[model samples]
Target: MDARKTIVIGVANGRGAGDPACQDGPEVLRSLKFLADLEQTHAGFSWDDPIRLAPGESSTPLDAVVQIGTQLAERVCSHLRQGNFPLVVGGDHSCAIGTWPGVKRVLGDKVRLGLIWFDAHMDSHTFDSSPSKRIHGMALACLLGIGDRRLADVADAGAKLLAADVCLIGVRSFESAEAALLAKLGARIYFMDEIRRRGLREVFAEALQRVGEHTAGYGISIDLDALDPAEEPGVGSPVAGGLSLGELTEALTQAHGDEKLLALEIVEYNPYRDTHFVTARAIHDLCQSLIP
Candidate 1:
């Protein structure tokens, strides 16, 4: 693999700063040896400078995060148009609002973009339905053409992803109203129960097929909380009974080979809560899988 084929962007905007540990996530990954490993194992892979939140900004402030993220998105989109794969290492799930728009801008309407969201929470909440109004939970809603107008208008010339092209994977818990809204929009969803019965292979296969069917290419947005708390405890909202590290690795290995996979974003890594940097290592390994 050509080293130039991959462009990794580390976004260090700790939106859920209630736990300061997230702010150190990017550095933790670097400290744990992700950068050196990528260079040695995948010759063509390299990372861009980490994009951090503006100093003194509040994470829960939806408008502020949106502005910072939109600027970051522009940088990421530029790389994508150059045909370099973007591997976004995130501060929180809210980063997707900016990252997805960048992907859309590069692809335009020439290719339909499918979203594969891996998370325990639905992340489909609009401001009205959000209990805490944390921007992290509402990122997906913003990307899907609903939510704060400022965020909804992030894509180039004011475009957002069509709901029909989005799919939610591993969602086991969500607000009732958000669930109904997702159902109404006809979003494809594979809940935990469904995954348990069909198995990860079949479920992942179906997810890729659904995204492929609707668009020319797809973007994968993974929230670490989608993994079981026991396996990945360094997340803001740790959920029980989530996928294990091995299960997630298998799913990613398959997805990385898909021709239609255009971009990938991994978010919500809180190093403060992590046990001996296990989560950081897991993230590094996942990135390695995708590069080659």
Candidate 2:
């Protein structure tokens, strides 16, 4: 019955991305010494068994993503039903297709869900629009009721989140189609340029306001690529300029213990690319900031 209890669910399948190395993200993070320290120090925080793809589900990338998303959704829904916070660490950003929908399922149809997506890319491309056709790039579009039907219908039929209730921050890389889609839908985007002008703390506060307005609850989805690649290079797709670790952690703490904040998801970690586990430590710091 303690709402402060957090269940960490690691979606260990990254088949939705062009690179599958990120699939190892969950396992690597689970073994980190800090996790054990967290377990002993915080009685409410614990890692559940990592979720993976079925043995024969590799027929297609979309199929694989859907299967993993479905499993993740069920796990998230179960944890939320128990009044625990769900912290989802992803194999790739494609986890959004599952994570948010699961939160929505727990909130029910009448409750509106909001989300603030932190990423280097817009993640708004559909199969037809994406040149690479990676589903990881299409997550937000699907959640906004725009992309492939299979993704939109994950935890339940229809959009998991509303465009009005959504905001994207730290976007500096995305194709025209995805940009056009978000523009047409009127979703708020605080591009890196704007974040630099306004500061991450200010932009994040505005984003929190935007997503929380009239919504029952909101969740934060952070793609590790949203951090500057020079500083955090262990992501599936690293961008040149992004948020700093110190600034981002400070901004996130603003929502700490905010009851309306439903869940948290951080994705796109590639252990193979990490230099000296710097990014791993960044992940630990991020989780530590928000852990109740």
Candidate 3:
């Protein structure tokens, strides 16, 4: 084992839900023995008492989601400073704003940070580009320093990552404007076609290499929509032709080798959309694999 303690954060803020059932995702996973199984698989792994954001209060006008996200990020940052591996379970993809700051605080100017975003959608929409203006769609842009000021400022002053340092994986669907912006920003993207041609192993290896090359460490953010809709129907955005659960597990397991990995955040699990806890179990399994 790496000797670094594993700390799981169950963020129960559900403002980003496409369906209301997502609000209960954390509790559903807990009731299904997600924590117990994780402990059984990795002796030293344990869950932190979940942090709950009040339902209506928010610190930002953009949405309550961003406010709660900031709160979550602060907690995650504190955990990393204590030498713990922070595993954030999500209410929505918007939580990445909260998650990335912790890494920024730890590495500071010493290391640039890279972001590996696994999702079916580009998640690169900005307020001007998105028709719906959903916060979830804008998260990637926020982290890359191009969205609402509140979100873009989540990281420490001058510590945010550049667009070149982010790699989008398993992106098979994207809005036209989002695609154009992504191209303009020169971000690296490995779509489903590329994954099929190169294989998951090579794809993940290349992604890690690219991100780790310039940064001291990188963040791993997986939106359940990156998985085939059949495998992860619980997500807010369900896209077809995505990675299988097995492939996702393998990629995440390999990511543990980078001692500089700051944290892992999983988002968009909607319990209302799920049938019989299928997505939750897959998420639990992935968490178990990454614990060591």
lDDT of each: 0.78, 0.90, 0.79
Tens-digit lDDT string for candidate 3 (1-292): 4877788888776665445455577777877775676676565677787766665564443657756767787888888888888988887777787788767877776668998999999888878888877777888877777867876777454337777888999998889988888899888999999999988889988988888898888888888899999767888878889999988887777776568677888888888888887898888877765664
Name the runs in model 3 displaced over 4 angstroms.
55-61, 155-159
| Pairs of residues clashing in candidate 2 | none
Residue 16's lDDT within candidate 2 is: 86
Off by over 4 Å in 1: 1-4, 16-20, 56-60, 157-159
Structural similarity to truth (TM-score) of each candidate = 0.93, 0.97, 0.93
Query: Whole-model lDDT, candidate 3?
Result: 0.79
Clashing pairs for predicted structure model 3, backbone only: 73-98
Each candidate's clash count = 4, 0, 1
Tell me the tens digit of each residue's lDDT in model 1 across 1-292: 2334777788877763345456567777766665576777665677788887667765556656777578778977998778788888878887888888888887776667889899998888887998877778888888877877876777554545777888888898889978987888888888999999988778988888888896878888888888898988888788899988888788778876555788888888988888877888778777765654
Candidate achieving the largest lDDT: 2
